[model samples]
Target: MLTAPVRTMILMVRHAEVHNPKDIVYGRLPGFGLSPRGEIQAERVARFLSARNADVIYTSPLLRARQTASVIAGQSNTATVRRSKSLIEVLTGYQGSPNSILVGGFSFYTPVKREGDESMDDVLRRMTNFLSLVIKRHAGEEVIAVSHADPIAILRLGLEGKPLTVENLHSVVYPERVSINQIVLGPDHVPQLTYFDVVRSMETAA
Candidate 1:
């Protein structure tokens, strides 16, 4: 029998690279799955989390994030994989555009907010709300959440007491495709970031 602990452990993982051959912005678009290399990255993460005895996994409904969560669920001790809209990618108006638009700061610099866009505050609220429910429902259990970079970064910023702004969002070193952020919540239900690192493949001794 597994015993619960005094604090809950949450692993926030960014989904692996997508199979976007055209290099276009796929913001919240359907049908974008993981690339071949991304599959390898997911496997590496699975091994890492399996070692930690992760109890369950919650993932964004997007294909890429769901695919990554599937790999982890299969390899880890995780009993179930649940879908949560709170972990979905940020809603952007740049979907289907060239990736350069985002890289060039054109999107963020735009003076007017688009109809379907999600502000930093929106992201923070949903992420924190999801977190509160998770902490209440699974206190002291190890859990994994597979999501996109912006949502994970925003959540991290809020938890770390940083300003939730686009400037900080871009400036913060978001988790890589093969990385995970570890957040620990104690009896008081306060989230604290312990570490975030790339899940490099395990090394073997010669």
Candidate 2:
């Protein structure tokens, strides 16, 4: 239980590298896990989180996200992981295309807006709501939400007061990059960015 003036924080984590040998956009279709090196990346992230205090973790139902959450939470206490639909990947009608959404990003979304896919605004709304709820619930505690690139990126951009366009989405957070976006919520429930850092991995350095 938190005492007076509880502090709340949440770490937004993008899932590690995925098994995309076929080079197709995975979207929310299913059946994708982390690559071998991606597992290493996950391990590094886990180690990184192990050095901090993560009271609870929330993950998208996607396997890659769940796996990443499991690895990180595994470094700490047990059974504190929960799945939230709001943390799922960007809804896309372009899952099976040879070109990934990262390549064209928001441009591909133009053709599928009427196909019932979620727009950038939709993702921002869902992610922001989810984040607010978690912060309020876990006041005075630290949490990690293992999510897809788009959702995490959208939330970061939204926090920074930027448009949720796909411009530079890939550059903001690379696939399986060891970056973490942290938001510290003040008592008024306003989130302040502590840091949006890309942790350099040993593989990337050497």
Candidate 3:
């Protein structure tokens, strides 16, 4: 029997810019929140998704992701932000450093097998697993998941069946672009991305 197409809009929102005046790597470092401009960007995202009628907002426990989710939910006057462990930042081998050359290494096949780090495939697994639960929870509804750049990129690449390299992380959405990725889930519990977008702005991100 031919099955009908099921639509579940999952707006993948990258957290707003951070308050890093010193320009530290700040990769998963605790206590970093949105910058002044980032707050503006969060407002823009909240406004952008205002029409989404979001059922529930999911966010990483990280301050930035949680802040973004709260702004969207507060502005939309709906959906209280929920801390989802699956939506948390990807664990990396590297902790904190200025040099980006040999920082946290990302993998697509095997787990990085380092201290507190995850492979790209691991990220893909958790991200997809989280999405599956969201689809099941809000079948036929729009939901928002706010997370970091690399994790979001991993999920997008995996959904398209594309391999991930260090460079592939560039395919992620910019901060506050309010990218809406419409995901369709099959009965077999697989999420197929039918639409993906990032609202690029000509002006500098505010």
Best by TM-score: 1
Q: Could you tell me which 10 consecutive residues in candidate 3 have the lowest summed lDDT? A: 194-203
Cα lDDT tens digits for candidate 1, 1-206 = 11124678889999988999999989888999999989988888887777786778999999999999999889875459999999998887777888876654554324434775887788889998888877778887888999988888888888878887667877777788858888888755356675555554343321
lDDT of 3 by residue, 1-206 (tens): 11114666677788887887666557678988999888877887777778778888889999988888888888776676778888777776454644344445534224453755787777888988888787677777778888876677778777766677656655543233345555555455456564333345424453
Q: Which RMSD values do the candidates have, in order?
A: 4.0, 3.8, 4.3
Better of 1 and 2 by lDDT: 1
What TM-score does candidate 3 reach? Answer: 0.79
Q: Can you rank all candidates by TM-score, best first?
A: 1, 2, 3
TM-score of each: 0.89, 0.85, 0.79
* Top candidate when judged by lDDT against the true structure: 1
Q: Tell me how candidate 2 scores on lDDT.
A: 0.76
lDDT pick, better of 2 and 3: 2
Model 1 segments more than 4 A misplaced: 1-6, 104-113, 188-190, 199-206
